[model samples]
Target: MRLFVGGLPPDITKRDVEGRFAPFGAVAGCDIVPSKGLGASPGECRGFAYVDFEPKDNASLARCLSL
Candidate 1:
């Protein structure tokens, strides 16, 4: 299941997100969405991130993550 993360630090980086989520499970991918006026390129995290994992177990692992 896809989940939404919120309440992250503005300066949060992909590496930082990976590190924080590593304990969760094998992250399929990490994306830091930039704001609209931010520009054509993706900017730093706007206080949230999306972490993709393996299976249902991964979803359970994600449950461990929160603000």
Candidate 2:
């Protein structure tokens, strides 16, 4: 399952997101949405991200905690 994490701090990184959700379950992948417009770096996030998990159950648990 793919989970959308929004309102993330500008300084947040992919490793940070993985670490936070690691306790919940294995993270298949994580991608922070890049900021748009002039002077935006690839490493910069648009205050949001998408985290992928193997099983739906783990994703569901993470979702609950996020809320």
Candidate 3:
């Protein structure tokens, strides 16, 4: 299952996201959206990201995440 994680710091990195969610379940992938404004820095994140988890671990991990 895929989850949307928002409100992250603009400089957040892929490794940072993966580390946080690693304990929850197996993260299949993590993509941090990049900023696109005129003054946005290179490699700066857009303060949001998508986290992909294995289907088998989705339900239980989702429950824990909600709490």
Q: Pick the candidate with the highest TM-score.
A: 3
Tens digits of per-residue lDDT for model 1, 1-67: 3446788876778888878776767777778766555353467567777777767566567567552
Residue pairs with backbone atoms closer than 3 Å in model 1 (clashes): none
TM-scores of the models, in the given order? Answer: 0.66, 0.76, 0.91
Whole-model lDDT, candidate 1? Answer: 0.69
CA lDDT of each prediction against the hidden true structure = 0.69, 0.84, 0.94
Count clashes in each candidate, considering only residues at least 3 apart in sequence or on different chains.
Answer: 0, 0, 0
By lDDT, the candidates rank as 3, 2, 1
lDDT for model 2, on a 0 to 1 scale?
A: 0.84
Q: RMSD, each candidate, Å? A: 3.7, 2.8, 1.1
Instruction: Give the distance in Å from residue 35's predicted Cα in candidate 2 to where it truly belongs.
Output: 0.3
State residue 54's C-alpha deviation in candidate 1, in Å.
Answer: 1.8
Runs in model 2 with CA error above 4 Å? 56-67
Q: What is the Cα-based TM-score of model 1?
A: 0.66
lDDT of 3 at 62: 74
Candidate 3's displacement at residue 43, Å, is 1.3
Candidate 3 residue-wise lDDT, 1-67, digit = tens: 8889999999899999999999999999999999998999999999999999999998889799799
Select the stronger candidate by TM-score from 1 and 3. Answer: 3
